[model samples]
Target: MPTVALIDYGSGNLRSAAKAVERAAADAGLSMTVTVTADADVVRRADRVILPGVGAFADCGRGLSAVPGMLDALGEAVIRGGRPMLGICVGMQLMATIGREHGDHAGLGWIGGEVLKLTPADPALKIPHMGWNELEIVSDHPVLRNLPAGAHGYFVHSYHFVCANPAHTLARVEYGGPVTAAIGRDNLVGTQFHPEKSQETGLALITNFLTWNP
Candidate 1:
């Protein structure tokens, strides 16, 4: 069975995310171990990794970096090791090159992008784009497989990822204008919305992530 390390670095919806991944594996009849861990050694050896975050970009970034060797382990395991990784919400934002949340903050630089504040064309729209938003599939990626048309993704965040390379964006949601719903590059995939909160659409994504070869 593949061991999936759900990194616990004082951030993210750790338990719920782990449970969701477990449920997805079970539903797909796939045997996978989803362990919530803070140990870098465990992460380095993990077959797969799930990073779930819920906070400001700078705070999440600092929290992740605070864990000794955790950052290196992630780079070793995901970048060099080429293990598949899924970053959720603020977790997804961390993958960007930089985050302009409060000020300019450094990111993992896994994906070529920047985390910017959400700017809906309509001023009446709320700042934190909370609630379910229909995803507009942009690119063909394994992480988005078997998703139905007009599938809605659950989101609750004030900031959104702005991809430097447009091809990195997998799917987008319309909130007055286009908001990035999902991002993918090589073995890394991330979602701005909480897949655990999403029903069928979320389940399908987690299942695909567990079984995704790339």
Candidate 2:
């Protein structure tokens, strides 16, 4: 069975995420063992890694950093080992070089970018870009396989990632403007929405991740 490490850094919707991944694996007919853990050893041995985060960027970054050897373990498994990894919502934002949520907070810097508050062109559009939005697939990636253009995903965030490399951007959504929805670089992928709460669209993405080789 393939092992998946759902890092428990005291943030993110842990239960929902685990359930989603497990279900995706089952739906895809892939035998996968999903472990929601903070253990560095477990993370190091994981075939696939998932980092999910909810709440403020600074708080999530601090919480992830609080874990002893957790970041190092992730680096070993994802960066060095070249294992496939996924980041969701604020988890994805944490992959940026820096986040300016409460203050100037550093991120994982896996993808060269900055997390900034979403500035909608229309004044009426709310701050927190909540509810369902259609995805505009910008690039082709294995994780996006079987997913249609304009697939709807659940989103609840006020900030967005501005990737330094435009080629890394996989998908975008229209709010008041083009808000980044997904990013990808080699084996790393991140989404600014909750796949667990995204219904069929989310399930397709989750399934793809489970079966994706890289």
Candidate 3:
């Protein structure tokens, strides 16, 4: 049985995310433990880690940093440890090198990118782009299985990740401008929107990640 650690930093909708993970695991017919903590050894020993966050990117980054050794634990698990890891919402943005929201700030740099505000080259589009949007899966990754090319998922964010390397981008959503919906490199996977807050397609995505062999 693989244990999935949901890092309980001070941010993120932890309860909702935990329930989503539990439900996803059950739907996949896989038994797993889902808990919130920042214990380094527990994170390293787990089969997977979920870095969930919400609110401002800078505050979220600071919260993660507040936890002693949390980043190093994640590094070990996702890099040297080879345990699968996922980042949700602002958590996903944290994986990038820089975020320009509320002021410029540093990120995890796991992926090369800058998190910038959703632009409106067209005045008709809304800021803080919210509600369900269509996802265009650009690759054949198993984590996206059963999801149509135009699957709709919930989104609520003002800033979006501009991936420096297009190869790392796995999915995209249009909000006046094309924004990265998800990005992945090896064992590290991230989503700019909250799959937990999304409905069926969101559930499917989480389930696939839990059961994914790669």
Candidate 4:
């Protein structure tokens, strides 16, 4: 059975995410072990990794960094080992080169980019870009398998990732304009929305991530 490590970095709803991934694995007929862990050793040994966060980028980044050897473990497991990894919401934002929320904070820099405030063209558009929004598929990826363009997912964030390489963008959403919904490079992929809260579309995405080979 594959082991999926849901990193507990004191940010997001870890239980909800664990339950969602558990359901996703079961529904996908995958024999997987899901563990919500803060221990670096457990994360280092897991076959798959998930980083989920729900708050400000700086706070989440700090939370992740606070873990004694968590960052180093992830670097060894995902970056050096090339294991498949996923990030959700603020977790995804933390993958950027830097995040400009609450101040300029350094990120994991797995994917070269910066997280900036969403600038919706329409003044009437909201800042957080909350609620369900349609996804426009920008690139073909295994994690997006069977998910067609315009699929809706739940979102709640004030900032979005601006990929330094346009080719790294996997999906986009039209808020007041084209807002990045997902980004991917090699074995790392991230979604700005909350897959656990996103109904069927979210489940499908989670399922895809679990079974994705690369």
TM-score of each: 0.98, 0.98, 0.96, 0.97
Q: Candidate 1 on 1-214: residue-level lDDT in tens?
A: 7899999989888878888899999999998888999999999999999999999999999999999999999999999999999999999999999999889999999999999999889999998999999998889898997886668999999999999999999999999799999999999999999999998899999999998998
Which residues of candidate 4, in runs, are more than 4 Å off? 148-150
- Which residue pairs collide, candidate 1? none
Model 3: per-residue lDDT, tens digit, 1-214?
7799999889989999999999999988888999888788788788989999889999999999988888888888888877788999999999999999989999999999999998957888887898998898887777777875467878888999989999888999877768899998888899887889888888989998997776
lDDT by residue (29-85, candidate 4, tens digit) is 899999999999999999999999999999998899999899999999999999999
Sorted by lDDT (best first), the order is 1, 2, 4, 3
Indicate whether candidate 1 or candidate 4 has the larger lDDT. 1
TM-score pick, better of 1 and 4: 1
| Model 3 TM-score relative to the real fold | 0.96
Which lDDT values do the candidates have, in the order given?
0.93, 0.93, 0.88, 0.92
Quote the RMSD, in angstroms, for model 4: 1.0
**Candidate 2, which segments miss by more than 4 Å at Cα?**
none
Model 1: how far residue 57 lies from native, Å: 0.5
Error of 3 at 12 (Å): 0.5
Poorest 10 consecutive residues by lDDT, candidate 3: 141-150
